[model samples]
Target: MVYSHSQVQLYKQCELRYAYKYIDRIPVPAEASLHLALGTSVHGALEFLYKEVQRLKVPSKESILEEYHSIRNEQITKIQEENKRSQLDQQQVADFAHMGVEYINWYYSTYHPFDQSIVMSTEEKVFPKLDDDIKFRWQIDRIDTQDDTFTIVDYKTSKRYPKDTDETFKDQINLYGRAIKQNYGSKFKKLIAKIVYLHLRNEIAREVTDEEMEKTRIKYSSIIQEIIKKTQRRSNGDKEAFKPVQWYRCDSCPFKMICPLFAHNYIHDEAVNLDDMKPTTIKAVIDEMAQMAYEIKRLKEQKDSYAKILGNYAAEKGYKRLYGNENKVIIGKSENYSPLPEKKNELESKLASENMLDDVVDIDRFKLTKKFKEHELDYDQYQDLVKKSVSITAQRPSKLKEKEIDEYMDIIGEE
Candidate 1:
């Protein structure tokens, strides 16, 4: 399948989301937001601005703003008509329009006269074939030629300006540079990438090194290969081939109604009648589990508060145990030992000299368990470690309502 930078990013963001969008071909209604509209309008205006520059004509601020408004208005109308559920209101649209004007104005004033470099093309499409089967199709906002060097310029309407060390954007732009280099290597000796953050009125420009280009190629190609592997596994009926990764963006994900991580949440929210949630069904179980989890969390919070007070009182009185009429409360304390930060090396060296380092150092239980299963360790050694370190934790489940539990527990009695 053909890929774009966005598709690669989507797969990186959440593999399940990529599978839903690409593999399953699930159709989620497009969400039109003011942010997207503003970005599009701004990009369109900038494309117009640079295209004019390419033709030896620099548009005035008024002209650019006019173009921006035209595009913004058209986009707003389209969103309002097509996306009836869109949350963007008139005030937000106007504000975003004004923000777009500000960005264009700042960008124009910062680099006026438009003679810094020769504009080779605006909104240039570059298709770089990775292999016989893999190809990426993307568009650069603008391309400039100056001093035998090609500069890939990308505009950003994002509020947050990325740092110099932000490799996500760096990798994306470098990929663009690589595409340009692959397509037109004979024309230029050097390549540069310029990311213009319009909202923040900032620009980050860097030379696209050959090392970065190669790294970008390998990194993205590996991601594509991973996608291929997951796709193949999915075709073979592996249900968990594409795991959903939770992030802040999951709250706004369009696939929440169907995504395994979040589908349960919407099951109740989207249900219509009592019949939709039968008591014997998984939906009922899910709802009950949710309620139990919330109740447990609340009870834990209260338990923690009481425990804190009891702990403080026990410490103040130097008491190990407090007696009630029938039930007794026990307060226990234990400290874990670790080498001091300043003298850890000295302590480790001393332990090593005495050949007692292994005795003191904690075993990685996970690795040990793996070794045990692989029969890498002798049964006696495994059993000794297990007896020394392993302990079973048992927990019992209970359902308790807020009204059934007492508001407070008396740990100390009056003298």
Candidate 2:
């Protein structure tokens, strides 16, 4: 499959959206914004600045600002014409245009004369093949060369600057570095990747090594393989293969009305003002259930908080049972075991070899403990089969007969 970094990121963000876009070939209307116009204008002005430098000509800061303003206004006019309900008013559009001009002026001042390196290309598109069938198609924002070393530079207009240790930006530049090496390996001696944050007026850079590139290749190749396999499964009648991953981006997603994960929310929202034709409405029931669920969650948090306090108090006092006026709280220990999924098959196989898999469901710890109590296995054998940990729990006994409480207390004492 021919993919780009953005396409791969979209797949990782939400499989259902990727399927709707790439697999189903669904067309979504584009929404225009002043922010996008500002970003595009800044990129265009910088491209003009660097391209002029390649010709032994350095454009003045005012000229670059003019280019930025022209680009911004053209886009803003188109956006207003197409999107009547656009949230960008005249003031917002003017502010964004001014911001674009500032970004261009800042960038031009920082890299004046533009002679640090030779410009190889701006907005160059490349197709790099990982294998015979797996390929990537992406665009490099800019490439510069200095003494056999190549630098891949990407422009960012985001308000939030990336941290020094941000892996996402690093991975993107690393991938671009690999593309350059693949295309011009004979001419390249070293690689450097950078993301220039025009808004924040700072940049993050990395020196790329061959070893890191290989690791990145393997990582993304594995993810692409998984996407392919899941796509095939989804095509072959497995409806659950590509499930929706609801996240912050869902609000801006055009496919949310059809996504199984959030379609019900849209339905409920639309039905909130329906006429009350019956004594009990479905919306009312759903609202009540939602409230109940919230209440249950709140109460669970409170109960867990109290349980922790009670458990700690009992431990400090060396008391297994704390008596209240109407109820008694018991502090006890329970054994728990949870085997990793990959280790389950080997564990079950070992148990079957010893003829101890009978009546055991999914390696249930309680059933295994019962078998141990019945003397079906020795202490060492049971311990080997399941590693157990004891956790203290606080339980309150209320509305219980004295005889029932005595029996429960006796059982706990014996254990």
RMSD per model, one decimal: 10.1, 14.0
Model 1 agreement with the true structure over 255-365: per-residue lDDT tens digits? 876777645433322433456655365544545777787789899999989878898999999999887799888997868987799999999999999999998898777
lDDT of 2: 0.78
- Cα deviation at 238, candidate 1, in Å, is 1.5
Candidate 1 structure, TM-score to reference? 0.68
Give the range of the ten consecutive residues with the poorest summed lDDT in model 2. Answer: 392-401
Give the best candidate by TM-score. Answer: 2
Q: Each model's TM-score, in the order given?
A: 0.68, 0.69
Q: What lDDT score belongs to each candidate, Candidate 1 first? A: 0.81, 0.78
